[model samples]
Target: MAETSLTELLERNARHVESLDSDHFAGVEDTQAPVAVSICCSDSRVPHDGMWDVTHPGWLFTPSTIGNQVWDIHDGERVVDGSLLYPMINTRTNVTLVVGHTGCGAVSAALDAVQNGPGMVPAGIEKWVDLIVPVVEAGLNDERIDADRDVSLVDQLVEYNVDRQIEFLLESDDVPETETVYGFVYDFQGVYSDERGRAYLVNADGETDVAALRELAPTKYHDAVDRLLQ
Candidate 1:
């Protein structure tokens, strides 16, 4: 970033620190017990804390990856990302949310790699993109999503990616069964019928049934509970 932009960012941080109370982080300074572990894409467009309305620090545990895939490549094998598992195993966090978004650049890149070729990218970025390629391939071949998708192919694949990540989390033997995984697509581009930033609860504990998700979600999240692909 430019020097001016970096200065502006630090100035913003200074303002934020000054705005907070001295005891804002008193309890969590020593120990943390987050309620949910959010594995979201590292997309600036997708507001992580603001979207969830999380102002407090300890309520939610945030872990972001390039495409929000739950697993990472290591020694030619896929292993669950440490950031997503540490809180689940060590802290009181039992709920896990795999949040994807419409028109995701990561999913688009993976789709391109699957359809075309792995085109030039840095080695670090290529790793995450490589992991997402299979999910794009699966979404392309899935008969259910083909029939259920109402948005563009990329947007549909975004939701499909969320499902795949949640699947990875659920199947991992290291993950506790009590840690429920919830899949959501943050619709900031009006892909779904809800409002501008409606976080659609696409899957709950691997269950993609929209009607069943309504039962699992609270009444306030009734509007947020929906599915584009059954």
Candidate 2:
């Protein structure tokens, strides 16, 4: 099965090469100034570039990790991961977008780890999940979250997690205050609304107020900008 999938991948790459124009990436070959640097969960369902309909190579800089975590353990300290920082420092990328999706397996694992004591897992996977466990614990303490409710706990945790990640980004000295951070929860389970696959703006520069978020967005998306926890 793996061999078949690998063959399909090569064939798909051949088709992609055939469809490309001569100058398709010529403009960005030397340098790149992407619209935004997006950090999202390592989920197969979420397409970081496709969400923005970005086909051009240099338009979006994507750095993904488990649980959509911005920080990684390095030498016994949690620091901003290099994959997310390298683009901002060199590519003139200012806008930082942190995207979390509903039904995130990472967040679910963290929730379980927090509630039931962590089960033994691979060390690398445990690192990311361990970071998220505290966020889940904090979310549970917040009045907005409920283990049982109309909105599923996992979905609510996903939104809360997005906000937490943005907060971490904002507080980091490594990240310039001049850079704007936008947090979004990509809804695919009809949890935020009936519109599946809609990326809802939940936080901007640490502001989670729905009214403020609506104002931050274009008038057309005001109704769409929503926070599940609130």
Candidate number of the best lDDT: 2
Residue pairs of candidate 2 with colliding backbone atoms: none
Window of ten residues with lowest summed lDDT in model 2: 1-10
RMSD to the true structure for each prediction, in A, is: 2.0, 1.5
Best by TM-score: 2
* 1-230: candidate 2 lDDT, tens digit per residue: 33458889899999999999989999898888897899999998999888888887999999899999999878998788888988877776889999999999999999999889998999989988999999999999999898779888988999999999888888889886668899998888888889998899999999999998888878988877998877
Across 18-100, the per-residue lDDT of candidate 1 in tens digits comes to 98998899899999999999988999888889889998899998989988889986788888999999999999588999999
Runs in model 2 with CA error above 4 Å? 1-4
Which whole-number lDDT from 0 to 100 does residue 64 have in model 2?
Answer: 94
